[model samples]
Target: MKSKIGIIIGREFNERVRKKSFIITTLLTPLLMLGLLVAPMLLSTYSGDEQKKIAVVDDSNIIGAHLQSTDEINFIETELPIEIARKEHLEEFAILHIGKDIMSNPSDIRLYTNSTASITMEMNIATQVKMVIENIKLQQQDIENLPAIIASIQTEVNMQSFANDTSEDSGDKANSSIVATVIAYLLSFILYMFILLYGSMVMQSVIEEKNSRVLEVMVSSVRPMEMMMGKILGVASVALLQIAIWLVIILGAGYFIIPELIPDEVAMAVAMLQQGASPETLNTDTDMSLLQAIATLTDVGYLAKIVVSLVVFMTGGFLLYAALFAAVGSAVDTPQDAQQLQTPITIPIILSLFVMLSVINDPGSDLAFWFSMIPLTSPIVMMARIPYDIPTWEILVSLGILVATFIATAWAAGKIYRTGILMHGSKPSFKELWKWLRFK
Candidate 1:
């Protein structure tokens, strides 16, 4: 049985991975992942490089004095009429027309452009007009303290976790929470994608074999259990290979690309860490600098733990879900038939992603506790809480349940796969599947 399974695994792994699509996907997936996230950030940052010149035809005369230029836009007050400004071609992007009594009707302010006005263009003009009007209203009401009141409002509150363990520094706790939340989010997302992608692949692999009646010939030589296990294991290897490459890319980007791209943000985060330094070590404020704080946050130890946890959950989740997907493929004659069976399998995966925000905010909550431990959701949910310091017992319990679930599901799926892989005609309903499972 072992030898047969090994041969099947090798053949399946070799045959599928050598395909043109598989090779191209493996090579391009890292590039695609980086592009999806980093492209928008980079593009948006440089989007406002060129300053747009907007001519202001302020009939009210009040707005022209207060309308100041910004990095992305330059405002110049003009005495020329609106009709003449349209034809003058002053190299301006747009013309803002402020009405004489805009104090009465704010909507009278209009932006006219040679081309259609963009959202940014409209917003810039509107903001200038609104700010002038607001300042006038505040003066009229004699509310000179408005600026001071606004400045005094605290927008961000520092959250400190008060667990039994207070030996950890507040700065360390804050940094860890940030790191844990980020790791949890990435892990949950990766697990969701890995499980769905590989699980569907397993189903499609089974469907292809069944549809061609190739399983009929294969069954005579290899036991159904061996064939099923071989297919799952073979596909698992493919998944691991893809993920290993992705992990290297992710770690590389974290170490190299991130700092070069967003230096200011990196500097600010490091500054924050320095500000929140440990209370006991308050004597050496001059010595602790931004570089040291940045180094602390990017600790090599924490990153390794996150990477290992991610690899484990991603593989385990794929294996657990792939069994059901394989069973669906064996029972169904067509991809459409498999869709009905996929809903039940996919719900828990989706639920895990949806509820992860709550878990990240409060990993010790009861809701997070049960969801992370339950076998169906554990594959994604447990990893989400692991970085936030999940209990040792809970991790053990979740792993035990997940492993057991995979074994039982695989055994059950094998029974259905053996009976249905060659039996194709009418679609199998839920009742028919129940009968197949009971077969000796």
Candidate 2:
């Protein structure tokens, strides 16, 4: 039986790889997805390079000097009228007016623009204004070492964790949480997509075979159980191969392209080792400690455990759904008939995705825990929660139940497959399917 399953898996893997659609989609899909992810950053970079011209009417010289030197800002030191500033091409000038009311209150700096200013421009103005106020305050108080005093003020609070016998740094804990959440989301989405894509493929294959009367000849030679197992194994092998190839490509690209493409600050953070800098001196702001950041990415053992659990759940989930799809195909004579039966399978997937999305923000919540424990939803929900630090016992229990559910579902689906594949013309109702399950 194992050998037969192996043969079926091997054949399915080979056939899928040879298909033009699979080959094209496997390569292009990742690239398209990567483009979407990076598009905003690319646009931001392009916009950052463009010069922003601002006309300043400085009645009081307090803010003009401080705001003049910001990057990509061409400060035009002009006393131009507001009308002239507005009439000038919008790309060429924005006006900043300092009112006479600033002698008593230095905070009265007004900006006039035709439309709402960009976030970058607003931030730059706010920062400059803040520095001016701080300097004025220092002068008023007659404090000479204000710069040193300000530098010594600690803006970031140091955090330490004491849980689960793990000595992870605060950064490591955060990274672990992030990586776990990302991995969970990725696994859930992948399972959802693969189940829909390949499960449909299985159904289509069954319908084609039945329509052409090929299933009649094929079933005479092999038991329905063997054939169903073979088909499932074959399709699953193809999915695994495609996934493996995509992983290799994505990893390779991330390794090589990321270093060259990412901002220097982020690159530096990713490259730094945790031990290289003292925990006190480490900058929490930049990606200067990427090596440390990645090192701190959850416990390696925990990550491995979650990954393995995801594979088990995803495989079992796919098999369970694909078996139902196969049975649906067997019962139907055409693709149109299969569509009506697909709602039962598709609804669960849609619900799982919806529930997983909601639970991700609050993985430890009661709703998340209960949904993840239920067999029909567990495969996706449990994966979504794994990144938030799930217990080993919960994983084990989920797997135990998932495996049992798969066995029961496969047995039930095989009975339906065996009975319906041979019968034609009259479509089976829910009652008919229950009767078919009792067939000897």
| Predicted structure with the largest TM-score when compared to the true one | 1
Task: Indicate which candidate wins on lDDT.
Answer: 1
- Per-residue alpha-carbon lDDT of model 2 for 1-440, expressed as tens digits? 33465666676678778989999999998898789888989987897787777777776766666665555677776666556755663665467777566646766777777566788787787677677767776778977787788889847554432125355543333344455556778878887888889889999988887889887987877788888888987887787777777767876676677567666665454445333344445555644234333644423455566557756877877888888899999999989988878889889888989999988888878888888887778888888887666676887787788778888999999999999889899777878988999989
User: What are the models' TM-scores?
Assistant: 0.80, 0.78
lDDT minimum window of 10 residues, candidate 2? 156-165
In candidate 1, stretches whose alpha carbon ends up further than 4 angstroms from where it belongs are 1-3, 81-92, 101-108, 113-121, 133-164, 167-172, 176-182, 256-297, 357-367
- Model 1: how far residue 92 lies from native, Å: 4.4
Candidate 1 residues 1-440, lDDT tens each?
A: 34599998898889878889988888798888778887999987898687788888989988787988988878888899888977784578888888889998988888878667678767766887788898888778876687887678847433443224456554353334555676788788888888999899999989999988889999989998898889998999888887787778777877796577546745555545446544344333332333343444466655677778777777778888888888999998889988887889999989988878788888888989899888889878888988776556888788888888899999999898888897888888888988999999
CA displacement after TM-score superposition, residue 351 of candidate 1 (Å): 3.4
Q: What is the TM-score of candidate 2?
A: 0.78
**lDDT, model 1, position 432:** 91
Q: How far is each candidate from the true structure, as Cα RMSD in Å?
A: 4.8, 5.0
